[model samples]
Target: MEIAIIKYNAGNTQSVLFALQRLGYKAVVTDDKKILSNADKVIFPGVGNAGAAMQSLQLTGLDKLIPALTQPVLGVCVGMQLLCNYSEEANTNCLGIINTSVKKFVSATKKIPHMGWNTIYNFNSILLDGVKQHEFVYYVHSYYAALCNASIATTDYILPYSAMLQQDNFYGVQFHAEKSAKAGDKILLNFLQLT
Candidate 1:
């Protein structure tokens, strides 16, 4: 299977690549429009600021290319945040593939980043296949997509937020599925099996 990882300046490409390697798939990281559109599956992995990430995608025309993807596309962490309509992180507009707004966490404890492992509920999506409900997944994000119509799963931090989102062939996850260990790997495997 041909899998392409959208390479921008957002970071975490190697980690996602390692995860796919463990899964027995040799995925290539590239920003070429033809290579991306021709791939069987695409992964957009980001671990950076929303505004900067969007800037990178736009500079290379990936901002226009990503939302137009026909095959199944997965966005991780900030990559997922970029799929929304807008982001409060840097007052940036995003790809708008999911039609939801990403917002900053209103933490009462001053814990802005919301780091470490968190449990996800309402795992009815195929991406969570063979993974147990309420399983802890590694997360490291200060912002989150609000619970919306496209939300297929939920996770509670300061309040309930989207753990997983799906709209047509686009899917987004708030946590780092690649770094979530067994549960993460299982979810990645499930995504690979998507038809």
Candidate 2:
């Protein structure tokens, strides 16, 4: 199947590519509107600041193109955060594909960035099929999306927040599914099976 991985200023493209390779799938990393629009599925993988990422998407006109995609689209980490309406990180407005807001963790007890493995539960979509609840997934982010109507999964650091989100064909994961080992691989496989 034709898959496209949206290339922007965000990092982790190679990691995601490798993950797909292991899954026996090939994907092209591009910012070309025609290529992206023609792909059967698209992956938006990112690890960077929200403001800078948005700037890159804007430069390539992907900020507008992404939200309009007809095929299933997956957003990882900051890429997921960008799918929300707004983010407290860098005071930036996001793609607004999901009706939620990203907020900074303001806890003095727990560590920032919420690094390392964490359990995700409350699955509400087919994206988590064959994946058990409270399964550990790798995460490395300082900000989190607030629980909203689109939230399909939840994870906790200082408090509960969206671990996964889905609205129509758009799906967002706040964790690095490519790096989450078995559980992550299962999620990616499930996303690929979407039709």
Candidate 3:
């Protein structure tokens, strides 16, 4: 299977590639428009400021390529944020593939970067196959996509936010599925099985 992982100025590409390798799938990291367009599946994995990430994508023309993808495209963490309409991070506009906005987490007692394992619930999608309700998944992010019509699942940190989002063939996850364990693996597999 030709699984393409978007290569850009972001962190955690190696981890995502390794995760896919562990699943016995060989995924390539590339920004080539053809490779991305022809891939069986595409994974947009990242960890960094949303604005910087957008800059990198635009620099490589990936910002335009990403939104036009017709295949199953999965965005992780900040990648998910970039799929939204806008991000508060540096006041940047996103790909607008999903009509939502990303906002920083505000809490009375919780700290920023809602890191560590968190539970996701109220999700029902082919991408979430084998994932139990309220299953724990790893997370390490500060900004979150507010709940919207595209939300497939919700997670609570200081408040409820979109844990998983889907719009057409584009799917996104607010959590780090690469770092997440068994549940995360299932999510990836389910995505690959999508037609």
Q: Which candidate would rank higher by TM-score, 1 or 2?
A: 2
Tell how far residue 121 is off in model 3, in angstroms: 0.4
TM-score of 3: 0.98
Expressed as tens digits, the lDDT of each residue in 31-67 for candidate 1 is 9899999999999999979999999988999999998
Report the C-alpha lDDT of model 3 over 132-189, residue by residue, as the tens digit. 9999999999899999999999999999999999999999999988889999999988
lDDT per residue as tens, model 2, 22-66: 999999998889999999999998888998899888888999999
Provide the lDDT at 14 for model 3.
94
Candidates in order, TM-scores: namely 0.98, 0.99, 0.98
**Window of ten residues with lowest summed lDDT in model 3:** 122-131
The per-model lDDT (C-alpha) reads 0.92, 0.94, 0.91
How many steric clashes between backbone atoms does each model show?
0, 0, 0
Task: TM-score for candidate 2, please give it.
Answer: 0.99
Root-mean-square deviation of every model:
0.8, 0.6, 0.8
